[model samples]
Target chain A: MTATSPTARTGQVASAQPSARPGKRGDRTGAASRAPWLLLAPFLALFILTFVLPIFVAVGSSFTKVTRSGLFGEAGVKSEFAGFSNYAQALADGSFVASIGRMLLFGVVQVPVMIVLCTVLALMLESASAKWPGFFRAAYFLPYGVPGVIATILWSFLYVPGLSPLFDVAALVGLTPDFLGANTVLWSIANIVTWSYTGYNMLIIVAQLKAIPGELYEAAKVDGASTWRVALSIQLPLIRPALVLTTVFSIIGTLQLFAEAQVLKTVAPTIDSQYTPNLSAYTTAFAYNDYNVAAAQAVLIAVAAFVLSFAFLKFTNRKSS
Target chain B: MTATVTPTSTSASPARTSAAGTRRSGSKGRPSTIIVTAVLVVVALYFLIPVYWVVVAATKSTEDLFSTNGFWFAPTVALWDNLAQVLSYDNGIFIRWFLNSVLYAGIGALLATYFAAAGGYALAKYEFRGRNLVFGTILGGVLVPGTATALPLFLLFSQLGLANTYWSVLLPSLVSPFGLFLCRIYSQATVDTSLIEAARLDGAGELRIFHTIGLRVLTPALVTVFLFQLVGIWNNYFLPLVMLSDSGLYPITLGLNNWLSQVDRLPEFYELTTGGVLLSIIPLSIAMVVLQRFWRGGLTEGSVK
Candidate 1:
């Protein structure tokens, strides 16, 4: 199905080629060619200022080390090229590495659960027999409208024993689980992430499901396929792109888990300042004042994100092919 | 086959038409359907519970908040008093943060949407040199997680003496790579090249044609991009946390977090924080409910394409 779509698009482009020839010729002229660039100028300018320059700055700073001077190392500091020493130090830091590992474990566990839940919710909402699908869809997605910090605060209330109704119910049952404990905090963070994003991801999958040609379902129905059968064979297979997209997004989001952990740190004493890689980078820069090491860690995090996402895309593409 | 499989005609709900083909047909009143619906309802309740808790918790005074049931309202309501206290605390700083958030998200999204539309329109409708390169670079930007750049941005802004200022947050928020990508896909699907060619043949300048013709056709997409960016900027915490030091320039997220961190010292801030959080979410929730179609369209356009 994926293979045919590109060829079909190419066929359309081929048929449309004759008409586009004159336009292409006209576009070669100086003024005509300049128009596209002119329209793109504002976006590119901001993109460079915000995206490109910062990346270059971060990359450059990552290779340099900061040196302190004076009695308390407060009077003067110098920065000089250190030739990957900062990277070495960042990779050597056990706590930073542990944070990254924790994030990886978090993503591994949380992402699949979130994706499955999103898929199920999306499928249920799109099912014909579901009542008030619109209401459920909106209710499921409303959390995406709330900011992560606010969501964390709300969940923190539920985690705290004195404040949470969940605790009251748990206590009555003789089971008091400490959600914000050092061991359980990771899962608690995962819960918040899933709650915040499940709807957003579900929306994406539902969009893909909506895009499926009705004739395909019609044909499947004529074959006496059940709703569950059609969903597994047609909807799930066809929505692969959306699933992969959501997974890649979830992976990136997981690695950059900062806001929920940061906000919960106020209430959950077990949540250290360096709970996630992003948080560690943040603390390293602001608290330790080691901008170079922080930059190195940031660069490493970006590289890891790129590598993981690219690998996932490649693996999925290879499998599909 | 079409008559039998099309689900909209079978569903009793009026809203089902919008979601027509996505739904399964002939499944109403089935046992599996009932189970599915029940599970979905439970999931919906799980999602809404936290927001509901906050709403109920916000109405209680600090004394009543701890004493009363956690999920229900207090016997005597104090929502108005909590709002007053939240607004008046630290000389009405919550109101300032609210305005700052409005400024950041409102103007930032507007400008970002415009830039995305213009850029996306060019990429979609016009053929130019290095177009692929430009698009590729933007795609690369989309994958570079925004948090990874926050510290670097802070450093760069500090170098330029822009740190702790409104521009620090506003400048970064103005560039939305994901929005640009969405706009590109949307413009491709919606905008017509023949119209542009005709406009050019009639001696309409490129800028005028885009402003008058292209933007008019792209209003739906523009709204989609705008809302996406608005929510993103509104929900943003880390960018401002790293960039700004002044409370006056803080967005609602940072402001509320600051208030929350101080709750350990003065528990009175709990009611204020809850009130502040509830207030902060109202605008975005309204936007979500009203502009639901556009963002949904934006999401589908983004992921499907």
Candidate 2:
């Protein structure tokens, strides 16, 4: 990459050195040619402060325990190393474990449904004879603008029994729908997730679809291929990168489910404070006054997210290769 | 931006699409096209339904909010009344929250976009030592869940005496690995090295060249990164919820959620919550429609990398 860079390619060798080198991360170069370093400074500083430091702090704090001398801590608080105890405590809480299981189930069902919907939407909108793709695309994407809490608040109206026309119509047909029931609220949250993000994932796929060269489509038509054939044979395989990208994000998102479930908790009895792992860690730290345990739970959640994404990546990459 | 990349491409697609349209209509009958249109329409409705319900529900009075059907307007039109009540309800705190949101999201996304552009341009156009290390770190950042960073960040901010300040939220919103990734891809494909060299030879400094030449060609990337982070920060709840405890510092998301969490006790807030949700979404929904072209143009050009 360095060799192919334009300055290197043009052989704009520095007066004192080759390629001006712009130095390195810590070359302490003269003031003349520090453009790249200047450019990268702001992002690097904040990235380290907010991103790198947090992970280090969370991990470092997770290993230690804090004990107060008395009920009100009249004596000084003592701190000591406590390896793996916080993790054990986090796992021992059945609600915390249940939260992880719930998120896994949500992802297993919702992520695939959302990804498939996005792919289908992308393909259909980009199809040869598709009409009004622009209008339809905007309609699908408008929900992405609505914040998660707001989206749930709007959807909760439809989930409430007496307020919902959906339930009213169901009852008229000699049936009753319990959207906020303990067993059904999870799927209702699933419905909200699908509504909120399909457009976003679809947009990415659409962008990828647009990048597909017109020559391929023309050749498929030259071969007298049908629309379905072109979609299956060419479009599906071609958009795999976008599909994989959306799926990985969707999985991470499924793990970090907080605001939507929190908003739905107002109407649904099923949604507890620890209904999702992200919410669980939040409750642990703020409500239970257990920062170390919360940090451990957070690390576990991050591990779950990484594992899920890597597993999905391996599955997709292996299949393609 | 997406109307036609160069207008010449437009001539080819319609001809091809119409040809395909007629052939499919002939073989599979008109039902095929109708089916496609029907399915597209249904999906569009599914996405639009929630927004439409909000718009309708916002117009009714608090009493009508419950007695009326969830999907339609009730007998009385209380749109203005609801707005007045929500606006004046708590000494007009909602407006303060709205402005706070604008401050956090608008300024944060703009600075973040510029940083991404500059950082991305550096990564793409220059080769420095540890470049791979920087890029590799950012790649790992992409895989890390953003929320996990929030709690620890709050702890650190409090330690630094920066908690409850706007900087806590604004500072973190400024670094987006994904935006930097997109800008890098866009810059690599679009920025002309020959132009940069020529400008340099003419005695234009690096920053001047970047501003004049590099950023000119990087509009698609700038627009994409700006809007992406704008939506992200604007809709963000967890970070602000953790960082700021002051009501005055609350963004619309937090303020609205605060009201929502109280609706069970004060059922009258139902109207306020509905009105607030509708009002909050309007600005971005309009932007979504108006900027749809730039989004298409930006993402279409640079998504591969």
When summed lDDT is taken over every stretch of 10 residues in candidate 2 chain A, the lowest stretch is A23-32
Candidate 1 Cα misplacement greater than 4 A, ranges: A1-28, A71-77, B1-28, B301-305
How much is the lDDT of residue B75 in candidate 2?
A: 82
lDDT of 1 by residue, B1-305 (tens): 11111222222232322233334556566555666576666677788888899999999999988888887888899999999999998999999999999999999999999999899988988877689999999999999999999899999989999999999999998888888887788788878889988988887888899899989988877887898898899999999999988888999999999988998999999999999989988888877766777767766666544
Query: For residues B1-305, what per-residue lDDT tens digits would candidate 2 score against the true structure?
Result: 11112222322333344444343243233444555566777778778877888889889887777787877889889999999888997899999999999999999999999988988998988877788899989889998898999999988999999999989999999999999999888999999989987986687877787788888899878999999999999989999998999999999999999998888899888889999999999999999888877888898888755
- Model 2 quality (TM-score): 0.91
- Poorest 10 consecutive residues of model 2 chain B by lDDT? B1-10
